[model samples]
Target: MRDAEYCFWHSPAHKEEAAEARRLGGQRRRRERVVNAVYELEGMTNVGSVQRLIEIAVQDTLGLENSVARNRVLGTLAQAALRVFEATEFESRLTALESVHERRGKGKR
Candidate 1:
């Protein structure tokens, strides 16, 4: 998943999440992993904070772009995305968030 998509999935609050979750289209565990990541991040920060802590949390907790540590990765991304709102624009962030799910999906170019 792209960095932008990662940001999106983490920040979105409304149907965007539902849509992305639907887009991901997989086992309940995968959906839970993604949503779970976003959920965990919402606590420390809401959105648009973007700071060193956020960066560290994302790369360390979420493993940057690697989902090998799936739960940890999502947790990290969710945290960073919530904070990144301050650093980046709205759509760019959304794209970043969804990118993760997009990559995980079965087919894409």
Candidate 2:
């Protein structure tokens, strides 16, 4: 067995350890999937996703016992929420402008 080319973890002497490692790895992956499903934070393609993330951060930070760290995190979340609001406002305005332009173009034809 000493002359075998198998790696330490793959060797027959460490078969149980290898099996346990594989089992733990699979368990971790399943847990992550469940957490991701619960949070739905995989693909943040829209403002709603960003808002949800900020909301979650704010909620979690509120429970912190350290005031300084809590306030810092809350401040950051506030700024992120403000930025998202601004972007939503801008998007609404741009959409309205595009609608007007489309209507004017139709009238010209």
TM-score top scorer: 2
lDDT of 1: 0.60
lDDT, model 2: 0.88
Put down candidate 2 lDDT per residue, 1-109, tens digits, no spaces. Answer: 5788898688988899899999999999999889768987764788998888888888888878878878888988899899999999999999999999999999999
Worst 10 residues of 2 by lDDT: 35-44
> In model 2, what lDDT does residue 85 have?
100
Angstrom error at residue 75, model 1: 4.6
Query: Could you estimate the TM-score for every candidate?
Result: 0.21, 0.69
RMSD of each: 21.7, 5.6
